[model samples]
Each structure stands twice: as structure tokens, then as C-alpha cells.
Target: MKLHGTVPVMLLPFRADESIDEAPFRKQVDFAIEAGAVAVCAPGFATEFYKLSDPERYWVAKTLVEQTARRVPAFVSTGCGSAHATIEFSQYAESMGADGLMVVAPKWCALGVKELTAFYEAVCRSVKIPVMLQDADFTGAGLPAKLFVELAERCPNFRFAKLEVLLPGSKCAEIIHLSGGKLQVLYGLGGVAMMDGLAHGATGMIPGSALVEVYAKIFRLYGAGQVDQARALFHRLLPYLVFALQHLELAVGIEKRVLYRRGVFPSDRLREPTLHLDNDYQKQMDELVDAVIGLVNEVKAATATRG
Candidate 1:
């Protein structure tokens, strides 16, 4: 089946000290469903997949699927930095009842396209569930759009791709041109490019900002056919989007902190080695949040003025 519709790249919840907060995690899933995500993803790049242990990963997937209760599709990130681990995660995830799998290119190895294809092929063949590709920077993961077209043709289970082609140009155009009305493209980076990405054929977006009411409206407005409204909202959220994208070190913390502050979860805890923001970053992050709120207020005022 083709990847279609709006799906939120769900974030995992954690307690104050950074342990898995299962109760709030499950609640976040329910909130996402309530907010109208047709499908949900677990422990992907946004969910801090790398920090999760095998057992913890399975626990989160099982919890999310259970909470979703077959209400919609549930996808879990199965790609570890290792192919062997990825195969294992895929098997465990499916056995635990995930609706599908989101596999990323091996980051630590910095695999080339060939290695990426081999890794995906191995994981897909090992599982009965459908799998999609998530391409990004250090993973050496961005496959040419043509290669994906071929993969979509060759791999029966290759259902979708989260194209994080950060740069704009021919490759982005190529993905749009070659999607062939087949694989559903998700706009991986969450910002102004979102509207353009959809115009280019990305049916969905894996944005953590979806957890935020205003940001989600930016996406929902577009999906609901209010193009100008959506563009207006996108610009409003652009500052936060840039903050999240620019501060690579603190991106995960930013999402977690924002969600925690919004009461989406119990705490903004990240697992060990993925520490929380420092006082300086936290101070800046606080200002960023203020700026986002200011922007939202400005948009609300502008919208009223337009009315």
C-alpha cells in the first residue's frame, strides 16, 4: 500500500530523571489520536531511538500499539546503528504488534546508498511487516529519488519514505518527479519547506511540533485546504523551527522540554549520554519559547486583522 495521509512522528515520554514514563507516553499516543493523526510513529529520530535499549524499545512500541488499540496504524523505528540490531528490532516490533516499521540508514557506519539498500533489504526480508526509509545527514542516507523509485518497484514491502532531503534543488525535484504517484513522501524537516514539500508530493510530515497545538494547525490548515492560513501559521512557527534545526545538539531536548511544558508528558527526560540542555541552552530555549508564544500571538492578531 502507498503511504498516504497525515501521520505524526510521535515523541517518547520520559520522567524527570530520564526513565521511560510509560503512563504519560501512552497518554501522548492517545492525545495524538485524539488530535487526528491517522497513524503514529514511535522512537524514531524524534523519539530518541538511539538511546533506547532493545527491551525498552519493545516496551514503548507495545505500549503505543496498545493505547492506539488498533484505532490507527502504529509504526516503530527499527533501524539501529547496526544492521543486526535493526533486524532484531524489526522482528521484536512486529512480534509485539507494530503496524509497520520505519528504518533509517546506519548512522555510525555512514553507509553509502548500496549499503543502505542492503541494510533495508535485509530488515524488510526478515519481517512480514511493511517498512519505510528515513534518510538524513550523517547516515550518508539520502538515496537519489530514482533509487527509491526502483526500490518501490522492487521491494514489495517498501511502502513509504520520509525524505529529509535538507537542501533544495534537483534532488528534491527528482523526488517529486519520480514519486510516480507511488510512495508517500513525508517532509522530514519541519519548517517553511513543508508547504512546498507537499506541493512536491510529500503526503505527510513527521514533525514533532505536531505536539504543539498551534504548529499542528499549520499542518492541519493546509490539509484542510486553507493554503493561505497554513502558510501564515508556518511563518509564525518558523522561529521555533529554526531554533530546533539549528541547535542540533539540543533538538531532542527542545522537543522534550516543549512537550513537557505543554503537559504532553510527565517530564522532559532523556536517557543517559543524551543529556538535557545546559543552563545557557535552557536560558536560550526559554527565550525561544517566549518568542514562539509572541509569534503565535502576533499571528492571532494578524489573522484577526485580516478578518
Candidate 2:
């Protein structure tokens, strides 16, 4: 399956004790597919993959693949601290029937181009499935576009790039231009830069799952030549996105809360060492979720009618 359109980076639902909440997690998978997600991804930054142990990571991957059940493509994030661990996770995801893998460069220590290239080459070569390089530079300095072109030329499975920089439009255009047509770009950062990224030739976006229906509608409108409609719809979502993306931990908390409000998740519990939304923040989030709930419902009802 081709990795394109709105693929949500899933939020792992947890119980009060921080154990994985299996039932609601399954509901989330079904919800994404029902809401028109082209694919589903998990254990990314938003999923709090850092907090998960190795066994928990594998379990999340396996459960996601199983819940998705090939209804649509499922992509798993397999970026680990070392190349060896990353390859191991990538192969495990592939073995569990994931359609693609999204790999983030190990962020514990910065690696030069040579080291980064070698790391990616090894992982891509180890898996037959398509690998998406996540250039997630939250600090505003992103990987050079030429590195992506170089990796594409070297590794057959290195086919996609996910741009999560401060402003990703130019980088998205540059990577596409440099690679000629070999690489497909997917914008992240909770789809905050989605319209700009789409205008710059991004194939899709990997946004948080709470509002997958709304995002999917925007993508379809853009693809159908309804640029004005798409822009207008995306503008309605801009405020909430800007608010949630202020901090990664804050974003995870907000997404899980929205999912809970929408009745997809039973609880909006984040693991310890996480940011807690104060009373003021909670009120603001509730207002934001209220502002868009109707729009989300309208989109879903329309989709169901069309189907």
C-alpha cells in the first residue's frame, strides 16, 4: 500500500496505572479507518514511545497491526537509539504485517551526515517494506535535503520523508526538487503546516488522531482541486493545532483528551514524567474541542452519506 494522505500518529491510550488500555486502543484503530484515514501509524513521538519499554513497544506494534487487520495501510515507527535496535524493531514491524516503517534519527546524540547515512542505509536495507525518514527537527534546524536524495539513490526501500521542522514547506519543495520524483514528502508537526506543505508538493500528512476526519476532508478537498474550500476548512483547524503544538507533552495530553471527549478513548491518562494540563489549560482545551466538534461531526456524517 502506498503511504499517502492523512495517516494519524496514534496516541496510546493508558489506564490510570499507565498500563496499555487494550479495549479503547482497538476502538481508536477502528475509529481512524472509519474516519477516512488512509493509513494508521503508532509509537511515534505523540505515542510517547520514549516511555515504552522494549516489550511494550513490540506489543503496541503488534496490536496496531492486528487491530488494523489490513483494512488500510499500517505504518509503525521503528526509530531506536542505535542502528541495531532500529533494525530489530523495523523487522519486527514488517514481520507483524505493517505496510511501512517510519524511522526518526536517534536524537540522544547528534550524528554527522556520514553516520546518519550509514544508519539509515542499514535499516532500509534490512527491510523490504518502504521506509519513511522522519526529519523531525523541533529545534528549527532540519537535515539537509541532499542527504535525502543521497539516501534515496542508495537504498531502494528509502522512499518517503516526513518533514517536522519549524517551517517545512521550503524543505519539502527542496527535497522533492532534488530527488526529482523519487521521494514523497509527508508533513508532520501535528499538521500545523499542512496547507503550506501540500502547496509545496507534500504527498500527505501524519497528524495526531483526534481529528482525523477533519484532516482527511482537507486533503480530499485539496486533491480534488477545491483549493479554496480546503484552505477555508484548514483555517478552522489552525487555532487548536497552534495551541496543542506549543509543547510535545502538552500535545499528547490534549490529543488524548480530545479522543476521550469524542468517546474514542476511555481515559485521557498520560504516563508519569509528563506534562499535566492545569485548570486554565484544561478550560482552554475544552473550548477548543467544543469549537470543532460540530465540524468533525458534519464531516463524518457527510462521509457516511457519500458512502
Candidate 3:
């Protein structure tokens, strides 16, 4: 119920023709569970939600929820450009049995505090499930900790947040303290600041799914009081994390390639107009993964041994 630990933001698999590859997508969900993710999320930024047609979006969310089947909690990003569409999507996700909903603020145009609150409030009111506000980086909108506290007070179901701020550690700490520990915050931004998020106050993470086991290990290590070990492992993976997150759009291609190489997905295909990682970058990515993969394996071994 707390939704702590790694709830990977899933990547959608596509066939060469650009159709949703259902089989691999399902496999990817199982892969996350096998790797020890606490929950699974879809229709998020990493899922290429904007690129998906309404049917594609619905199918992906419905399939993910059905496949997850309450094995772990599943949350869907139901944010749309308007409150009406957001409510519709949120309700549909709930109908598909999503345990919770994550709504990023409406974008392309800024909303006044009152309008933004109303948008989130409308979505929150439409669902019986818990709602998490996604503080996205796409918009340059700066959400103060007070806004979250105010939303939590207004909507009883507004209990969780996915923070993607510049200074997430200090901001997370501030939100927790200001909210009297009522709001649970999860670190977004592909888990780049995961250790900082955890050390500061993040109860969980919603990172790209290419390496759930790695993040899971970090979370486990931290929780088990192995701060030094956790920090070391995090540093070990820092290179790969840095490269993959360098260009946000390009990061999607990089992650799909990682999953492809890992055999989690059949192919690393993205919709058109995507940033292509040149051969040089691809080689660097290969080397980065090679360097950090052992650390991942070692962390997995450590976790198994600890158990």
C-alpha cells in the first residue's frame, strides 16, 4: 500500500512496422517482476505515451494491468492536456484494475496554481484509487512543496508524488517535513539521483525498467542498513545512468537497446522523429553496460546471499 521501492516506468516495445509488440511488452513486465520490482507502471513518459494512439494507450495500460494481475501494485500515468480527458483516462485505468493513478500536470501552457489544483482535483475525485501527482520536467513549472501539501489536504486520496525537480533531495526532504510525513514521494528522472532521493527521504523510485534489479539492490541495501554498499553500487552504475539520461528523448532509445541486448525485448524500435544514437555513442553505451553489468550481477548475488 505504501508503494515503496522500484516501480519501474515501463518502456513500450514496438515491431519493425511500428505496431505495439504485445508479447514482448508482457515479457518486459514479467522481467521487471523477476528482477524484483515492487510495482509496475505504464503509459508514462518512458512508455512514449505521447506517441501512442488512444487505442494503443488503452491496450498497453489494460494489458499491463491484466498481466500484472495484482502480483504487485500497478499505477498508470493518466495525465492528458485537459481535465476532462484526464478524468476519462484515469477512470479507464481504474476500470482496468490499476491500483493507483499518476497524473502529470497539463503541459504546453502553464496553469495557475488554482487551475492546476483544480485539474488534479478533478482527476482525484473521479477515481476511488489513490492518486500520485507526477512532477514532470517537460514543463518548466516549478511546484513548491507547499502546493503538494495543499493538494494532499484537499484530496484525501492525493497521498503520493513522483518528484522530478532539480534539487530532488532537498526538495523531497522539504516536502516530507512540510507535509508532516503525510505525503510519500518517489524519485523520478530515471533514478539518476536515486541514492540522494533515498538518503534524503524518497520512499521509492520510478525509474526506467532496463535495470530494475540494480535499483532494487540499491533500495534493498539502503533499507538493510548497508549504506556504504548501496552507495558503492550506485556509483558503479552511475556511468551507464549518466549516458542513458544525457538526452531525455535519446534515453528512451538507449534503454530499449539495453533491454533488447538483455533479451527482455525482441527489438529496440522507437517511433519516427526520435533521436538516433550514433555508432560512437552505441559503442560507448556497450562499454558502459559492460563495465556496470558485473556490479549488477554482484549486487544480485549479494541480495540473494543476504536472503
Candidate 4:
């Protein structure tokens, strides 16, 4: 399937006791689809994949694929620390009907190009569905464009890239150019550089699920040549993106809080080893949400009316 447009990485809803809340989890899936998301993703970094047990991860992948029910693409993040494990999970996701797989290299230690290439090749070869390489290096030194081109040539299923570096425009341009337009690029990093990435030829964005409709509006506006309006709307929401992305754990916590406030989630309970939002941070988050909640509600209403 062609993966494009705003595909939000879903927040895993939890009850006050910290167990996975299945009812709200399914509600979130329906909410994203109703809000105009082209696709939905799960167990991403934003979903706190590291904190989940293996069974929970598999359950999440199964639940997302089942819940999406082919209404839109459901891409599962299956990047384990070992190539063997990654391939195992990828196969499982494919069997569970995931439309695609998003794989990130092991972040515990830096692997050379040869090792990384081998790892990705094995994964692409293992699954029949398309694979999206997630270049999530916070240091901004992501894998080389040459490696991406070579992988695309070698693995016919390696058709997409999710660029999550510090600044992704240049890398997006380089990869698209090098891959002869065969590799579709999507931008992450909470869609902070979304406008820039679009200007550089990114096909889509994978942002958090709290504001899927808002991002969809910005994307549609830009695609319709309403650049100025898109810019204005994106700028209005930039502060919240910047605030939430200050840290990974902070992003997860804040996004859950936003979902809770929106009534998509019943509670904003995060798993352990999480960054607790202090009172000052909570106050600031409340203020930022206050600034954008109206726009969010407006977009949701318009989308529902159109649908």
C-alpha cells in the first residue's frame, strides 16, 4: 500500500492501576480514523515500546491490526535489539495483517554501515509487506543516503523511510534524489519540521495521535497550495509540539495527558520509569492545550460533518 498523509503513532492508554485499557485503546483507534488519519501506528517510541513486555507488544500489534480492520493502513513498529528478534516480530506482524513495518536500528550502540545494512536486509527479506526504515538518531547523524539507495535496490520491499533526525529536509532531499523517487519519505520528530519536510518532498508525517485532525488540515491545506494558511496553522500549533518533545518520556506523558483532556483516553497514567510532569510543567501544558483545543474541536467537527 502507498503510505502517505498524517499517520499518528497511537498512545497506549492505561488504567489507574497501570494495566492496558482495552476499551479506550479501541476507542483511540476509531477516533484517529474518524479524525482523518490516513493510517495508524502503535508501540512506537511514543507508545513506550521499551516499557512493554513481549506479550504486550504482540497484543498491541494484533489489536491495532484487528481494530483498524483495513479501513486504513496499520503500520507496526517491530524494531527489536537483535536482527533475529526483529525478523520474528516482523513476521508476526505480517501474519497479523499489519500493512507495513517500521524498523529502527538498535539504539544501545552504534553499528557500522555493514552491520546495519545486514540487519535491515534480513528484516525486509523476512516480510512480504513493505518495510519503513526509521532513522531516529537524535544526534542528527542518521544512516547515509547511499545506504538507503542500496537497500532499496537490494530489497524490493524496502519502499519507505521515516526520517527523524534533528533536521530532516536535507536528508529527505538526499534520499529521494538518491533513490530515484522509489523510496517514499515520511517525517517524524513529532512533525515539528513538517512544513520544511513537505517543501523537501516528504510524502507524509507520523505524529502523535492527540492532534491527527489538526495535522491533517495542515497537510491538506499545503497540498492544495494554501501554503500561507498551512504555515499559519502549523505555527499556531508549533509551541505545543516543541513543548511536548523536550524529552521522549515527556512527550509520551504529555501526549497521554492531551488525549485524556480530549476525552479519547480515560486516564493519563504512564508506565514506570516515566518522566512525571511537575506542577509547573503541567500548568504550562494545560495552557498550551487551551490554546489549541478549540482548533482541534473545530477540525473534528468539520471532519465529522464532511464524513
lDDT of 2: 0.90
Higher-ranked by lDDT: 1 or 3? 3
What are the TM-scores, per candidate, against the unseen true structure?
0.85, 0.97, 0.96, 0.97
RMSD of each: 3.6, 1.3, 1.5, 1.4
In candidate 4, which residue ranges exceed 4 Å CA deviation?
301-307
Compute the lDDT for candidate 3. Answer: 0.86
Q: Please give the CA lDDT of all the candidate structures.
A: 0.71, 0.90, 0.86, 0.90
In candidate 3, stretches whose alpha carbon ends up further than 4 angstroms from where it belongs are 138-141, 305-307
Of candidate 2, the 10-residue stretch with the lowest lDDT total is 1-10
- What are the per-residue Cα lDDT tens digits for candidate 3 across 1-307? 6977998989999888899888889999999998989999988889999899988888988998998988999998888888888899999999989999989988879678888888888889898999999988633436877888988898899989898877777888888998999999998888888988988989999888888988888887899899998898788878887887777777787788788888888888898868876899878977876666666677778777988
Where does candidate 1 stray beyond 4 Å?
1-6, 138-141, 168-173, 209-212, 223-225, 274-280, 290-307
Per-residue lDDT of model 2, residues 54-137, tens digit only: 999999899999999989988999999999999999999999999999999898997999999999999999999999999989
List residue ranges in candidate 2 displaced over 4 A: 304-307
Predicted candidate 1 versus true structure: per-residue lDDT over 47-164, tens digit per residue = 7777777787778778877888888888888777788988988888898888999887776654566767777788888888888888665333367776677776778788777777
Q: Count the backbone clashes (under 3 Å) in each candidate.
A: 0, 0, 0, 0
Which of candidates 1 and 4 is the stronger one according to lDDT?
4
Find the number of clashing residue pairs for candidate 1: 0
